[model samples]
Target: MKRLVLVALVALALGGCATTAPYGNFVQPPVTVDQQQLAGDAAKQLAALWPPAKTRFELQQPTPDEFGAALVGNLRSSGYAVLEYAPQKASGAGNATPEQKDADPVVVVTPTTVALPLRYVLDHDAGTGLYRLTLLVGSQSITRPYLEQNRVLIPAGYWVRKE
Candidate 1:
């Protein structure tokens, strides 16, 4: 009887050792938003005729510094006022040159990604995931036909300010 009880205790100990903390507790490393979306013809058409607007801007990305350069380039080409936060000493030059000129609104873009649970395991643990993010400023002001068509539209409430 005592031997049987000892064996049972050993089994319990082994089972306890086999248990592990869930994977959800780990912090996910930040990811970049590589996909680019344009406001399309309406914006391009408007920008072409109208002079670029003067404004202050800042772009924040959860990814690396190079992501900022890409965003700046895209925004400039689309005709938005893009500056490095100082409106007074703004450089009218973008990745493009003077003859072609770029777009306006002095846009600041911040791109980031957040992990979303795919499904809960046993109704309490996240098994897989996805990322959803959006532009906090001027997102509503402009229409993104490509984003809508692709179904990558960031919902209204998911806006997170880029730091």
Candidate 2:
């Protein structure tokens, strides 16, 4: 009975560690600037790591604001096909008319090629008056720091890319 109980306890502990989610969801903070220039710079750096035309990006986070918009635009301009995911609102608490359902039919695209999932983190340090933008693509990540002055952001240092 003692050995059986120990095995049960071990199984329970291992069960708690299992998770289905591929990655943790992080809240993206707002930025003061539109970040067009910064996004362009980041896009250029990312293009060096991954060829823009060859690689397709599926952005894992919603970009409802300026910085996200800028990043998406920049990535597109850099020849990347970026797909941003946004959750669809339930129609009237799941009671939708047939007409409504017909109007918005769910279209799923199964590409022959795999698109890399991309995530980004934009954080501001109040004490240092600096902004850090980190882009994570597949298993790699690149981070760059920026300093804001008079509504313009200047690069504080070189990008640090990590595999």
Candidate 3:
């Protein structure tokens, strides 16, 4: 009985080390308004935190949805060299750019390039009729709330940054 109990405890301890994916499915509901404005707002806030010309990002989520595409465009327009690829596949691939369909093949790392991993989450609160956008970069994050009225989304509050 003592040996059996010890074995069970060891198995449970090993199981505790397992981890799931860090990211969840991006929630983008259909809206009548263009998402570029919202995405541009987010990009502007991000650029304020980390200068786009000095920073490079590897986007962890590669969803081809409207918000994702718009965010990428906004980031690029802000002068950020964003990398869109699967994190798992990029492992052990060195600095070589991975081949992706319909994506620009250019992910070069330089000495001055501040490469940081980035992810975003957009969620809508049905009860309050507000949308929240969260952008995570490395160990830092910024969140902003937006309200949709007259078929347009506008910032509802000041952006909050967390380190």
What are the lDDT figures for the candidates, one per model? 0.36, 0.79, 0.79
Residues 57-155, model 1: lDDT tens digits: 343222223323455565567656554433255664665565446445466965342211111001111242333322334322221222222434332
Writing each residue's lDDT as its tens digit, candidate 3 over 25-111 gives 244555666677888898888888888788898888775778888888899989999888575644543644555444575688665
On TM-score, the stronger of 1 and 3 is 3
Assess candidate 1 and give its lDDT: 0.36
Off by over 4 Å in 1: 1-56, 60-66, 85-127, 138-163
Q: Where does candidate 1 have its weakest 10-residue lDDT segment?
A: 116-125
Off by over 4 Å in 3: 1-28, 90-114
| Total residue pair clashes for candidate 3 | 0
User: Per TM-score, what order, best first?
Assistant: 3, 2, 1
Q: TM-score each candidate.
A: 0.27, 0.68, 0.70
Error of 3 at 136 (Å): 0.3
